[model samples]
Target: MAAGIMLFEQKGFSETSIQDIVDMLGVTKGTFYYYFKSKEELLMDIHLRYIEALLENQKRIIEDSTKTIKEKVFEIVYMLIHNIEKQGRQARIFFREMKHLNEDHLKKIVEKRDLFRYNLQLLIEEGMRNGEFRDDLPPSIATLTVLGAANWSYQWFQPDGKLSDFEVAKHMVSILLEGIEKK
Candidate 1:
């Protein structure tokens, strides 16, 4: 799986061959075929693991009773940014290679992805109901905006840069909750 991820990240899912992955791991075709029936299956496994981890972390963050909705939102965004930095290749694979999955595989992944989105939206709805966030905007749109802002960062986020994921997440949350123009 590690070999497949590296090859997919380096050469993209469609371009990467099973032989390339097996060679990277110093294994033979029989060894690779023994575990996974097809290359797409390996990519699917990587995608499943990546998103499932995010969903699990998200559930934990959302379930913390002590944290307010605002805090929960911050943590959710922070978690995503942190995960992207920690698992850059996996994140890249999840975002970029999703369309390559077969219909059945894609459907399963989309379900999990929707569940993740729904959970975030639920948190935003809760905040609105509690008068924590502005009630003027639709919760769905707000949730999408928050997620889109954070998810889009993976394209350019640098883990080894001067700033940490924590710092970037905070800045992003601030811009999200507060406008860029002077208050």
Candidate 2:
């Protein structure tokens, strides 16, 4: 699956073939076929795994009741950043290779992605209710801003770069909640 995902990202899904994956894996076609009926199945598996991991992490962040809504939001952003750092390749594949999934698979993945967004929206709503966030702003919009900033971090963020994931998360939280300029 790892090899398949790498190949899919390095090349496009349409461009990548089962033969390419098997050749990269240095295994027989039979070995690849034994695990996945087709390349599409393997890509779907990768997507499922990536989304499940993300949801699991987000759920945990929300479930930790000791933290205030603001803190939880910060943690959620941090968690997402950390995930990219920890699973950069898979994250790339998750976003880039999603288009290759058939309608049924795409629908399922979209559902999970929406679920993740919904959870973030709930967090934003909670913040509004608790007076930690501005109620004037739409919860959905704020949630999208936060999620978009974190989700899109994969484009330029390097796990081994100068700035740590935590640093990026902190900056993001500040940007989302407080904006720029000195108080």
Q: Judging by lDDT against the true structure, name the best candidate.
A: 1
lDDT of each: 0.93, 0.89
User: Candidate 1 local accuracy as lDDT?
Assistant: 0.93
lDDT of 2 at 170: 91
Question: RMSD per prediction, one decimal?
Answer: 0.8, 1.1
> Which 10 consecutive positions of candidate 1 have the poorest summed lDDT?
174-183
The TM-score of candidate 1 is: 0.97
Q: Quote the lDDT for 131 in model 2.
A: 87
What number of clashing residue pairs does each candidate have, in the order they appear? Answer: 0, 0
Residue by residue across 1-183, what tens digits does model 1's lDDT show?
A: 999988899999989999898888888999998999999999899989999999999999999999999899999999999999999999999999999999999999999999999999999999989988999998889999999999998998999898999999999999988869996
Pairing residues by index, what is the TM-score of model 2?
Answer: 0.95
TM-score against native, each model: 0.97, 0.95
- Give a tens-digit lDDT track for model 2, residues 25-120: 799999998999888899999999999988998899899989899898898899888998888888888888788899999999999999999998
